[model samples]
Target: MSAPPAPLSELPLASRQDGSHPRPQLIRSTWADLDGTWSFRHDDADTGLAAGWCAGLPAAQEIIVPFPPESVASGIAEPGFHRVVWYARTVSADDVATAGRSEHAPVVLLHFGAVDYRARVWIDGRFVGEHEGGHTPFTFDVTALVADGADHVLVVRAEDDPHDLTQPRGKQDWHEDAHAIWYRRTTGIWQTVWLEAVPATSIAHLRWLPAGPAAVDLSVRLRGRPAAGARLRVALRFDERDEDLGTIDVDVPATATSVDVTVPIARQRNGQAEDELTWSPERPRLVDATVSLLDADGGVTDAVSSYLGVRTVGVARGAFLLNGRPYDVRSVLNQGFWPDSHLAAPSRGALRREVELIKDLGFTACRIHQKIEDPRFLYWSDRLGLLLWGETPGAYEFSATAVQRLTREWMDAVDRDASHPSLVTWVPFNESWGIQHVADDPAQQAYSRALTDLTRALDPTRPVVSNDGWEQQNSDIITVHDYEGDGAVLARTYADEAARDRLLSGMGPAGRRILVDGAEDRGQPVMLTEFGGIAFQPGTRRADGWGYTAATDAEDWIARITALYDAVRASTFLAGSCYTQLTDTMQETNGLLTAGREPKAPIEQIRKAVRGRP
Candidate 1:
């Protein structure tokens, strides 16, 4: 056919780069996105390493960067599995225009948003570094090699075993065909790859936590060698109403790489204004801040821009609390897949619109099912005001290798996303998919609990769900999954105190124990985390699609969904409820919207159902 349409990554800018800062958590002015056309090939035989293809790939076709070769958007939608792949691209002078080349030994980092499985990289044919884990980002400092001031070619080789059951491949069917809950695979480089130049000394990572009613705490980590008499300055503002909520300056110790400081904000005189200063789905007030690293002479050496929302999350009196208020949570299970892009988003605007669409449908939170989302999505969630339940993709098999892979990757995901104010909960496991025997297996139960405790150690600010839906080894929130189609049956099952007590004790929903650790009630909040999968597509059947339950017509679909919401709301037991899903995937058609994100019913009806209102 004719030439395919230009990919989004290659298109020129008007409202470009998805309309948000790349790497929103920490942003410096000196950076550029390496997200365009690239030379590509599938090394199915795995001869690239021995053949020395890392130095260069002589014969390769063109494909779009950031879009996996499995996707149509990549211009190389190969259906068959390829265990190995290689990509090559030249770094243009324009790409490095902002990376100040004059500084003596300035640090320049090549940041990969994400690469599936394991990725090995080379700069100008010289080996640089490699990173494992498919979801979280990794950066390599190429300053030493690229400092020669010449052309540089980035060649990447990625290895992913389609048959590896122990790998944390979430919802990716190993077989050639997509079936059941599993969808397509994203083999390599499914996110943006870019570069940033920073001063020798800089701020590496940090997080802002709501310390109390009137203060927020900061844990800042510095990179490189600390200078004597050096200092760090931070300034905070809200809505630009106050230029400086607090201006903090602390002297940096010569040997210290990290520092913690508490910034106290002036309490608002008006109660409503004070509430507005806090972040929520209704009123998303963001606190903007600037971080500056000063040299011994007090001259700014490295400066970056960042922001956070002031909020706290907890479980108290058997209810989920946000900002100390018993806020009811309405969540949707988001697979974050696209017809054109699979696991990767179609565009940056799509990421923003995804958040707006969830809000439009009246969801307070989104359980990002089985995948670590792009940081751009988290940035929009923080900006547009939506809560998130961060969940990791599970491995199908239980083994030491599986546990080790899932645990390390999950922790890295937690560390990358813990700074986002919108992330309210950490779900390390789901449905006990990896540790399937956790309910009766002592070893599995201990591993699950240990993982939960480890997540807490990483970020104590958010609640940890040891294993969601069923067979939970440890959890701060008791969640259960039930797909009972009838609203009347669903209501009666969770009608009164006795039914609630029964569920907390031994009886389970979906025929799986809610708590498998054999412990008494810890007085945790109970939620209908998964329910109501009413599948209804308006047109003819395609792709042999199906759902947990099917609806007849649009009106019937809306009514059935509404009745379930009403039942959940009427129950005296549940603090919150999450529906089965937001959009229909390949073979699973039980979605309020289609895979392309088109609403099956009217937006108003869906929003009303989600809100539990007429």
Candidate 2:
């Protein structure tokens, strides 16, 4: 809004895009995005015990919000920023007050879109809360600690060891191991930073499930007691002028832990039942719903708004399907890395630009391979209409114990992002990273199957890729990757007998495959999910082993991808195909966009090869 608040590299670590012809804003709902100047400093240690931790810690260095400390977007691209760092900023107490207040609201929330690994926040030198996961968003209420209207200081201490023994660090290499795949790390606050004012009895999280036709079941959990004899009523509104769907009384006892409130979906103006709006590549429709918490006497207690779409995704007929239709997903493998910002997105505009570029290139979906994308990306996909296949970051080791914890964290990620309409599939393990004794290891295969089953249990609306290019397991869509084979070898290898076994057994790395002829159908189709990474040389000189080059220049790259896409399309046995990438990420120059999001390969070449050429 306000001139995008200078470049993230020039400001502090606080901070927090483009295509689709006339695409809608990707966010499910709009809110103030906090990405401007904030006070920042490097923490001296992990204890957060530095003197003058409150009342602002010295200089007013303007740190960019949302870009992570180590990123160029943070205005401080100092290496090893992930080792340990401290940040401090200040917000007003008046900021938390409502237009009309009794002067007694107990808590104020300081929200961080995401903080890598671990974080401890102090308000006025009083510890408020600590968070462990780095890739997911978290919030803390600092009301009790800060003095009202006294200009309180907020201190944040964050630590991220990319090579840590326990945490999950996807594709992040601390050192300069910028070869194939691995990229750099993003530490500290890398997402939105803001504060929300809520009543002491306000609602916390919402869980709304759309069950049956044109109806959604609802449950709201709140903090503090409801006003005496007050009854909570929930309403669903679809439009500004539409009549609110009649509110339903929420039954909650004083001792109750949660309130059960069911609000009916709205009916159309023409008297027909409101049709369920589901989101998919072909037709993306989102329904906006606002939930208002009412007191027993019909007084409005608090209201928080959110949006949802009624879509079903699953693996069927050997391929991922949406809304019961056979959806052939043409995807680009997205690494979620940036040259300036590293793992964190440089800016919201940058995220939108990347998604728009992917769609413009005729790709219908993206494999958010390994790293979990920022919520804003999912927000855009849900709003702007892009399909997403999400995967867990590969860990360094695996076992029954390790896999169990990994499974839980993976499920947590799914729950965190369950409401977005763009997410179509969940991938647990990729290329056997961290997997030990996978081949011929029944235990490993079983571990994979268990995780897949776990995903189904968590959210059955989407399909599960139990293992992608790892030893076979019970999965919905059968997926594989290919890179080692040349043009002729790749073309013929799919039909090879040995290759068929490998495909069936879900074995083989790039360039080689073994297909199975008689494997029982899991009701899912087959896909060469990762292939066609034909690296043609860019015109500029690239360091040896730094870029992809099956031949040279954009033309060669286009030819190879075109051939691969044609072969895949011609094969009736293939369900879909995803190119190696959407953009050239970091050292992997095979992407359509150079690392800087500049210099795209010839669009005509991609259209000729990928779009209707076959």
Candidate 3:
């Protein structure tokens, strides 16, 4: 079936229109990215030439607004220049004009959907703001730096040295070479760039939290002078029903970061009064919240609205649980890679299609494997009611500085995506990657523990997998990746077969026992985390292009993967399982769909195999 065209706002800013498709609701509304041609430079200039970088900039390159430079969709396939690049664009207050607005709006904001590594933004050639971390969005109020209603020149400098540094580069490598598991380095203006007009003395941002049982804790921060009697009024709403939960008032001082307020269930209504709306794959409920800053006189100054779903996810007694119930995570390991778009998908519809495909196959959840997914993907998962296990990208080595940087990236990623109901798990490190000398590495263990603690502290609603596939260092879930693909062995251990068989036939172990003696454990709740990588080549295709495997046809791919699935179904102990991947990547042919977004095996075969039915 042909895919539906993506929504306008989800497209590159250049393609979005004022009145095109049906207006999609934007949770955290920000007006940015509607402007003139952006200037591009593949390399950064020295301080001597930095001043003239935006002035007399190069001609229009016709690159798409939001796609990354390395992506084919971005119209720039310069893979060689992946480390340092600069982008400059200009926007006027009129560029972001509202329906009925006067010329008095004070602060004009500049926003970046995301930028890799470190980035410094300059407005009208004056330094405005700098941000670290690439995966999460950041914004700067550049109003005072530019003229009131005139065109403002914006310049951005982004530098990414992936593998060589302590920064959280994920699967990105400094070398221009793409090797096993690592793809091309995507650098510079990967996400969207936009602008917004707001009052100079307004609410900067809101940090909304779900504090259990119809209670939401909000911390609102305002720009300009907070010490001079600035305050904020917060309100919660159930979007599906359009019902308001009243509002709360809080005072803020100038030197303070943000003002806090608690919205209670007794006084306010959150979505449907279904007794604490806990979200799950079967029942996903999201609470719409609007936060507004009011002047001391109680007049609205600035407002921003977002959504949050109340749910509790954790690992208890060797099984993953949701809302205090044992919930087996039947999932697929999603790589989030496309043949054409590399890290980013061609369109939001493409992302939605992936989620739909998973749902059609009768799986309840998915483990978004390594790389962080685009926000729209999570949005669909929440709306379509699919559980998600979010994980930090695995790296080759783990250093103290690297762990610190990873922690920051993790915090930003989870913070930005915490509102989505689909997400239920946060995995800090993946199977021995970046981990060396696990036996005596106190620092490594401590770092892993710290990240787990930090993640819990940030959003205590979800479970945290401290280390997936390795040492059982106090992780919430004892996750094990068994690639053996033997049904009898799994069933025996999982079914509590016998001690003799567990030692002799290599079977029969049960209930959270660690078998560190083997290469990887095969026990209760045994998840086939990295199995069924049977590659099948579609005729005339270059199966050798990608390196994971090279089986020569659809029949072979189905045969091997189906056999593995059959074995897994026979195991009584296996509570959950995840196929190696959902789709084929650049060099990984084990995907159900080819890197070109073509289905390799028959759809019927995939549906039956994944659902564990004949």
Candidate 4:
């Protein structure tokens, strides 16, 4: 197979030796990034484990960490599929010591941003842990395994079978070549891998739920068991200032692993009016906070910095509400694929740039299509105030294994991203890829309902879309996809009261029912989640690049897109619309920007089109 194309553009933060911490919400002062080059080899026979390769692999070539082997940025641009791959790196004593080593001994945690399909880790020839999901952060505590003042070898085995329909592969092309909507396959590590040092009794996870304009609910989960007299202290402050909003102290029972505490926010603090601190796209407001575990003697055992946005999302009266007001969601579909990096962004700046560019184009939200995006992307969205729909990458065929794999991965993704305030919805399925018989088969329908229920159970604060585009089962919102190129037809189909009623009552676009049997709309908010895939390739059409309707020229492309937006706006039923993408990917040229993120039309014009303004 030919190697993927090299990156057309480089961000300032893109480097082989990136040392930045991966997770921004939960910040630890002492951590080391292990994102540089690492010893790597493909284990085709899967005999590396028997050969004692975990201790050290002989004749292993160097490959860049974080970037997948399929991508050009990984240095080893071997695009062929290998079910298993091995990666090894050495961590020095100093690397662990820099993380606030104490006489009591610190807990060293090895974190992987993501590893495709499944991953197993070993430190100093001792097995640590394994993770199944490919799009969520997983960690292994190796404090007991690695001795201080010594060099330790870290070995990882990542196994993936993209062609296996049982696995949740998302947009990773299962075939040998990219076809239809699927692109190049991403195998092994595709995100940041790093190490963090923390106190033995540190805060493991946090969930920030904005109660209202006046209060925020904070949930804390502890990593290790604390002492009998240990207490959790939380202090909240505005990100823009050092003034304290409020503070809460919660006593934890020795057996308690988690605590939920509500902290009140004063409208006026220190003679300053702070009532306008609500988070929104116009003015993104973040409240910085610190969680500390204090012992009986008032000695701080552990502290971590985190930020939260005070915003609530709800759907009511056929409208999506943000902060209890009707908020129109102007969004674009982001597939989260780069021409060079595949599923991985070249840098954190690249992720920020993507969000910034989308926001600059007058979009209020991004529907991260199929792929569960990097946490850094969600971080930028939370910091910059862009609404997000956290979507699950779909599996093609339904099976017991597919259900298990998707359930495990979907829950992991929801848990990992539910803390972000910008995440407005959890989409577990898209267009019925895995459960193709969802509309007719009772088993598929039950599975769909189960996924929706699971998502709600995991994150009740956000809406759950069981199947985003069509073949809807039980969903909080009624969403559909239609690529009717004509604006008048779209308006007639979705805008006209009589036509819309018929569509909602029976079949929607593509002769699929808008609601499943025994399911009622119940005034749920409606969104045109996917539409307007106007393709514009400036020059020659590459073999793998195409779109729904090819634009004759730039002006024609702009006119078509603007018209589609106009139709969407004219539709009184649509609470929101997601334009068919942010950027082009292999075999898909229907993006406003090319695969390299070059604008096809004027930014202002695109903004006008997106915002439904002439």
Question: Which candidate should be chosen as best, given lDDT against the real structure?
Answer: 1
Q: Order the candidates by TM-score, highest first.
A: 1, 4, 2, 3
Once fitted onto the true fold, the runs of candidate 3 whose alpha carbons sit more than 4 angstroms away are 1-30, 34-37, 44-51, 54-62, 96-105, 162-165, 224-234, 239-256, 266-276, 394-397, 485-528, 540-552, 570-575
Quote the lDDT for 602 in model 1.
84
- Model 4 C-alpha lDDT per residue in residues 1-614, reported as the tens digit of each score: 11111111211111111225487777755567788899999998999999999898889999988889988989888888799999999988877776545554367788889999799998878889899978888988888876567898999999998678888888888888888888888999998887777666778898888666677888898888888887888887774765677788889888888888988887633224443777788877778777777787766777777788877889999899887788888899998999888898988789889998999888999999888888888878877779999889888889998898889888888877777888998899988889888889999999999999988887788888878888886889889888899988888887756766787887777778778868986888889999988877877555445777778778888889888888988887888888998998887889999889988888888888787663
Give the poorly placed runs of model 1, Cα more than 4 Å off: 1-19, 240-242, 268-273, 541-543
Q: Whose lDDT is higher: candidate 3's or candidate 4's?
A: 4
Candidate no. 4 TM-score: 0.94
Tens digits of lDDT, candidate 3, 547-591: 334556677666666667776666544556777777776666667
Q: For model 2, what is the error of residue 279's alpha carbon versus the real structure, in angstroms, after optimal superposition?
A: 2.3
RMSD to the hidden true structure, all candidates: 5.8, 6.9, 6.9, 6.7
Off by over 4 Å in 4: 1-19, 268-275, 540-544
Backbone clashes per model, in order? Answer: 0, 42, 13, 0
Question: What is the alpha-carbon RMSD of candidate 2 to the true structure?
Answer: 6.9
**TM-score for each model:** 0.95, 0.84, 0.82, 0.94
